[model samples]
Target: MSLFFKNYKPNTSIYNRQVLWRCNSTTATQNTEDEEEFRVLDILKKRDRQQKRVVRRIEVQPDRTTKMKPDQNWGNVWPGPRSFHPASVPLPLRQGYVPKGQAPPGKYANAELMKIPNFLHLTPPVIKTQCEAIKKFCTEWPKLLNSEEAIEKHYPVEIITSDYCHGSPSIRNPLARIVTLRIKLSSLNLDQHARDKFLRIVGDRYNETTDLVTLTADRCPVRKQNLDYVNYLLTASYHEAWTYEDWETEKTEQDMEYYNWDNNASKRSLVDWYLKVNNDDRSLTEEEYKAFDISVIPHGVEYKDAVYSLMNDGESDATIKNYATAVRKLLGLPVKVDRDV
Candidate 1:
């Protein structure tokens, strides 16, 4: 019985060791492939050394204190990974949050991480046909601009003017005309809302209230991870509104999902609705709520009813005024600047 137990234990231990060895082998293989791909990227970048672009330099240290010899011109090798892929790095590293003692890993773990630089620059991969046309335009620009027939044909989107300090009359003049002969989005499978936005950008319609771009409110920052999903396209000066009624309905639905219903299940009072709109996911405590001005501004086109309700409930006029100011600031409208005498 003793002999059988010893034999069984050794066999079980050997099997466990075999499994561990296999796992290590698989991981090593993956790491080697990753390194080889990095090497290939270095080679491709070296080929494009003459292209006008930004170059990154990475310093390597053998350890925490010992300095690795400076390899200033390592045959034009691209900076390994981190400098190339900021977003691919874990959120902690991207946000500059490192644990007390751990060294940060390189931002990008693989070649797929190359998409990050494109995201940061807001540049998409160029279409092959468009690239070919750009090449042709660059090579024969002078003749094309001078041709009366070509001028009459007219391109869709053209550079009306630019400060070209260095090149031929076609390129160097501040008023050199370069037009995009290619139409990009006409072929895209865009939704109606996006299509309308495109038209507005190209100035195809009247009464367009939308701006092509807007700076986000600093108080409510956009998610760093989701920024890659943002639309990065050429917008017309004015065409049409991007959001249709259906889109607004959908937006309302999303907002409702975050709202909390009371235990009583009574119709949510105006006070409750007002409070929800005024604050984000978090809420002020009862004391904080007491400090808030529940009053509405009578002068504004909307919310006069709410202000009157708060005042009727005995909220101070000074508190209401301060609340109005806070509301404006929250909405990203400019705050009135005060000068002290």
Candidate 2:
């Protein structure tokens, strides 16, 4: 019985160690089980992490805009046309579309501020400074050309052009390439025939009211080319006006666009009629009539003017009335009353 009791004691010690190991494993697995419910304390711990946030420090720096001097060189700050920068610009500019009650957005980080055009760079002082810088390259204008008349005398051909400025991708404007040339008709050394022909050739381009001929050229791609084209057009028209055409000889006195009192058949008829009535012998030779002055007679000047207005300007009420008056004066008859001539 003593031998059996000693072997059972060693087996009991081994069984005790095995039972402790099993208890530890079961406790460790109890919290990780599928059936385990979450506690209130664990739920609070998860939510508390999201709630606890550190307060951030805002380090505000001083802006340097208040330090600008009244006479500061603005060209150095803004050299040319550019987008608006909030901190750089000193003015308190506001822009943007907002609700009727709401005010416009301020300059700070404003998209509207950048979109609006500002001429801050073109301030008077900046413009004066720029002009002074480039003044060394400019020469004094001639004293002789002080008056507009003197300028026109020396420069008969006045060429006009245009310039445009805007925020476009391309700097060129199509209308700016067009060139206009203007000159007084009297400025050209044209005779009576040439002047008449020039007026006819240019058509509506010549302003009879101002005696100014205007020519515009825009067919070319560039301004310089259009300028040259206008100049060429004026020269071609002037030269062509002076040259007589062979077909022009076919044009009769009646076919002439202009009327000349001295060169018409009416003047010869008047001379012959006067000589037949006044002279015992007709002294109406071509040389004698050519030497004779039409205005020497009593109402001959009035008659010539009436005939001139009738032929040049088509017959109007006033022209017909004037013609009848002059005819009555030449015949020494009393004036008619109350009826339209």
Candidate 3:
């Protein structure tokens, strides 16, 4: 029957309807069952692959030299005989992948593949359980303390108000747990009493001082002195929050003032430069004359030495003193000159 069906072809001939019907029904049923079984097996294979991902192991050797043998692989993925050498081959029940210096794609997908074993084998079997508890606590507490939400959940009451403390967006209130968790997270030399002092400093900046606790229901204390409060206000303000426009205005004003001074000095120096150039006194140009600011620049700047010596001119002692005072006012300093006492 199989050979006849293999040789059969659907030519344009009307015959054998019953045989064709039986062949089609049997073939469809076999194909459907085969596909279903293949799918089930495929799912089971995937599950097996996932189960082998994070296999951990430890090793023991009788002597240090026996541990150094190179032929034995560390992990289960490599194939070899169960040869009993004294070398440090893995024991029956050490728990993460001891990759043979090379990891597979499927095994590497497990995030815990690189982590240490879930168990430990001790030389003295008595201490193994205690060591495990210590390891578990040391590993897990840090992961909790590193997160702010965990700290707040565990330690709700803070010694200080949480306002003055600031940190990254992920760490909303790091100050609240800064000291409580600091002992676990950081290695500062601070004892519990010192931590209390630090928390007080942080809280007091936000008007959370001891005095604020004494507020009455009916009456509020009116501020007697604005000076201290205003100073506090200024100190509390963040100085670097100036706008771009403010900086631009300041820079522009500075540039204009610098150029004005440069122009004025150039004009004053030109009066001397021209005298040296021409060897004759001549009227100055309109630009040079305009550059000299009369309100700001003094006439004595051109003849400051002559003005100083003229102080000892024959006049009353009060007049001479007034001249000395005027010179000091103009030069922005008192000049020491020899005069009869």
lDDT of each: 0.42, 0.86, 0.42
- Per-residue accuracy of model 2 over 224-265 as CA lDDT, tens digit each: 999999989999999999998898888877777799777777
lDDT of 1 at 231: 20
Which pairs of residues collide in candidate 3? Answer: 55-96, 56-94, 56-95, 56-96
lDDT of 3 by residue, 162-264 (tens): 2342233443443332221011212223333333333343343333222121111112122222323433333332221221244444554235422232234
Q: Which of the numbered candidates is closest to the native, going by highest lDDT?
A: 2
If scored against the real structure, what TM-score would every candidate get?
Answer: 0.17, 0.64, 0.14
Q: Residue 210 CA error for candidate 2 (Å)?
A: 2.2
Badly placed stretches (over 4 Å) of model 3 are 1-110, 113-256, 288-341
The best candidate by TM-score is 2
Question: Order the candidates by TM-score, highest first — what do you get?
Answer: 2, 1, 3
The better-scoring model by TM-score among 1 and 3 is 1
Error of 1 at 231 (Å): 17
Clashing residue pairs in candidate 2 are none
